[model samples]
Target: MPPLFKHPNFVHFWIGQIASSFAFQMLSVGIGWQMYDLTNSPMALGLVGLCQFLPQLLLTLVVGHVADRYNRRLICVCTRFTMAMTVGILAYGNITDSISANMIYLCAALLGTARAFEMPANQAILPNLIPNELLSRAVSAIASAREISVIAGPALGGLIYLIGPTTLYLSSMSCFLVSCVIMFFLHYNFTVKTKSPISMEHLFGGLRFIRGNKVILGSVSLDMFAVLLGGATALLPIVAKDILHTEAWGLGLLRCSPAVGALLMSIYLARRPLTHSVGKIMFAAVAVFGVATILFGLSENLILSMIALVLLGSSDMISVVIRSTLVQLETPDDMRGRVSAANSVFIGSSNQLGEFESGVTAAWFGVVPAIIVGGVGTIAVVGLWMYLFPNLLKRDTLEQ
Candidate 1:
């Protein structure tokens, strides 16, 4: 068996992840493209992200407890099943030409709720699927899987969009079916160490743990702030249409560029995991991410912009692998759900809230200035975080 595929459970789990993530990425491409196409308003695009993120902010602890106390494979099955139904409705609406913007917002909210519950269990389940020794490589393997989805999803979504919105939605619904089937076959007995009463602390323990652990606190917060400011994915539709002078096809290639870089980097990291000065490397990677974002914002030329995105994806993947390793390895098996839930909030804000910010900012200032300023803010956040979380910055090695 290969290093990442050493365990059968891990193999099944990864297969499920592939389908789930593929559906998600394709859904994202469809939503962003469709919303922008409908309203021609950047704010509408931002609202899509906001509706998706708000559910996690409200139900973080509740979902965390569910992950801890429940059968996670079952949770994965149930959520994706709902997602399939929801997207199926979208497909029907598109075919009927009756899917209103309000309906899209409502659908996005449902999808977000499902994702909020799904992420904690999904993240927490990984430790049970593989041994501690293989964790670093496993994390890389996971990134590779996600990057593959990111690479293929947009490219495919954009191509399929040429056929019609119904085609795109139907494709996503099918991917969700595959995810559900794989989850059913995944066999892993999750051992929950928590035998305590359901108290407020038990519910919120993950947040407390992260609060005290400067490393987790610093790393998660850093990601939250950096990407919260630096992410340009939300503005890409605008860039592709208004600035790059490209249509849906060009948008697909642009979206794929970063993941292309990430997929290549993940293959390298899987074979030769980072072993020393891990903290320093992570910070440097974020800085690189910030610079790449800036370069992308300024470039009007398609080739230069694509190269910048590749750098952005590569650097961000390094940061992701390091943070995931640090957070997961440091937590006890039982607290993984809560901690991962807390981590998911950070991720949701980085991605979803960041999208909102991009739209709002673009509405206030032009898209070009909004993107450039956000990239600068990302760089600033890194410096500030480096100062605040010195332990994370000075820390070395992925193996605790």
Candidate 2:
């Protein structure tokens, strides 16, 4: 096997993720476009985020427990299969021209439930698939592949949208089906056939562990809050259409541009690896992310906005690499699923809640104002977190 593809499971797993990532990207673009077009209301866009995130927010504890006690591989396969089915139904509706805002919302809810389960299982399964020595590289490799998918998927989705919305939905369903099939080939299986009785103590264990470890707490919480405040993805549709005066093609390109920067950065991280001032680097990256977002909000020109987005993505990639490595390395395998579950909840809240916030704020204030305010809030979060997690800031390296 090549250095990047050392473990057979990792290879198969990474391939599945790339396919699914592309599908997910397309789903996002298609739905975002459709929602805005159907209602032409900013709040409707906000509801899209709310519907998708509600399941994860409501079921985090239960989902994590299930991941820990069940076969992680099988869980991933099942959840993704469920997702495929949900997307297939959406495709059918699109093909029939019977898709309503209400129908789309329902599909989003089902997909979110499937995703809520898949995320923790997928994260927990990674360390088990490859050697510890190769974990960082594996992580980077996975991130890079996912970024590639995001880059291509949006562009493809846009082109497909031009052909017909039905084509785009069907294409996403095909990708999801392919991902589910490929994921089933992993050879090693880990499962706890019989789980202990469920209890409040067990449910909150992941939270306790994280709170006790300042390093992990700082890293995870920082990301959760920073991205929550800084993220402008929820408004990108608005920017691509009303602000930049671009159509579906431009929207697709705008979506893909950030991933291009992220893809390039992930490749660099895979090769060189971050060896020093890991915590400081993460903080710096987040601050840069905030600054870039502010610039993006201010830019009216398409080229400048794209440049800002590239910077935004590259900065975010650095934070992602650092945070994921820290969380995985610091956690024990037995507890990884629960911890990852907790992490997923935080992420879900940030991304989804942020979307809702942007929509409401955009509705109340204006798109540009809401975005600029988010950027400033993100910068403030970095400063406050740096102070709170001084140990994380003083920490020297990624090596444990």
Candidate 3:
């Protein structure tokens, strides 16, 4: 048997992640589609991102502290339950025709609250479930599974949305419920030692630790800046409706194309794997992502747009694998939750803030110009980061 799938715990975790990811993807697609249908404005989609990420940014430090001081499994279970309840409420609203933009914003805020705690716990627990030798492969497998969910979920949601938005919401709720059950059965021997009292001092400690780690800081900064600048997902509705002249199904394909490319690349990575030159790979892949985004913005043809999205997805996946492996390998076990929380801040900021940037830019300078400029800015940021962080650029292997 392959070392990557050797542990039952890892297998269970993988299954649970797959289920949750699929449901999450459905919720994402449904929300965007419904919001656009209601408001017909790019800013409304951006607002959705804002509502979801603001809580994560504000609460990440506290959540990280709690994760480190408590049983991670307990944290995961509680967060999942919270998320399920939020989805259930959204589902009820949708089914009864009471769904409104305001209701979605409220639900999104609740979901964000759950995510602030859930992300760190999820990132930290994976290492505890497997041996170090298998860690990189495990991360790759999980990324691949997520990519698969991205590929399948949006397409499915798009088709299901044609039937009704409630269908997708209900499906997402079920996935979360099932995930909670699966999480309950997982067995692990994890225990937090010497629970520290919550204080400003402990929170400061996490910030100081992250500040001192140059490689970790640089890698995360690179990812954050690039995504913040080049991400065009929030304006995908504009591209789908105005540029590509398509409907909900087309919107779903546009969203799913990147994941399709990402899943394919992830599969290749899992098979051969890249044990070195990861930094260089990440840099080049992000550059490719920028170029793809530019092409996507420029193209009016649906086929061309899909191609661009696919390349963007492929490049983004490469960066994700490299950064995640680096973070997991370098972080100390005790500090994993805190560091992962910091990671969530960077990631959440990039995604949510990027949406805001895209929406405002699109509203001001036209959608195509906004997307093109964002891509150009992304490429420039990568070049600048490479020049500034020479050591980071040369980091070819995961820290031992």
Query: Whose lDDT is greatest here?
Result: 1
Worst 10 residues of 3 by lDDT: 201-210
Alpha-carbon runs more than 4 Å astray in model 2: 31-45, 94-101, 161-167, 191-194, 233-254, 297-301, 356-373
Evaluated with TM-score, which candidate comes out highest? Answer: 3
How far does residue 345 in candidate 1 sit from its true spot (Å)? 1.2
**Per-residue CA lDDT of candidate 3, range 1-400, in tens?**
7777778999889998988888888889999999999889978987898898888889978888877877887788788888888888877987788888999899999998998898998899898998876777788899899988877787787888888887778888888878877887889777649866778878766567767887788788888988999978778888999999999889978877888888888887777678888778888988998999899989999999999988998888888877887788888878888899988888877887788799899989999999999999989988998998787789887655
Worst 10 residues of 1 by lDDT: 188-197
- Give the Cα lDDT of each candidate: 0.89, 0.85, 0.85
lDDT of 2 by residue, 281-303 (tens): 99999999999989989998889
Off by over 4 Å in 3: 29-48, 91-105, 158-170, 240-250, 298-300, 363-366
Q: How many residue pairs clash in model 2?
A: 0
Cα lDDT for residue 18, model 2? 92
**What's the best-to-worst order under lDDT?**
1, 2, 3
lDDT tens digits, residues 1-400, model 1? 5767878888888888998898988889899999888899978987898898889899999999888888888988999998999999899889889988998999999998998899998988888888887888888998999989877777788888889889899999999999999898888785656578899989989999999999999988988887899879778988999999998888978878888999988988989899999999999999999899889999998889999999998998899889999999999878888999999888876786787799899999999889899889988988999999999999998766
TM-score: model 1 vs. ground truth: 0.87
- Note the residue pairs that clash in candidate 2: none
- Give me the displacement of residue 258 in model 2, in angstroms: 2.4
User: Residue pairs in steric clash, candidate 1?
Assistant: none
Stretches of candidate 1 exceeding 4 Å from the true structure: 29-46, 91-103, 158-168, 192-194, 237-251, 298-300, 356-373
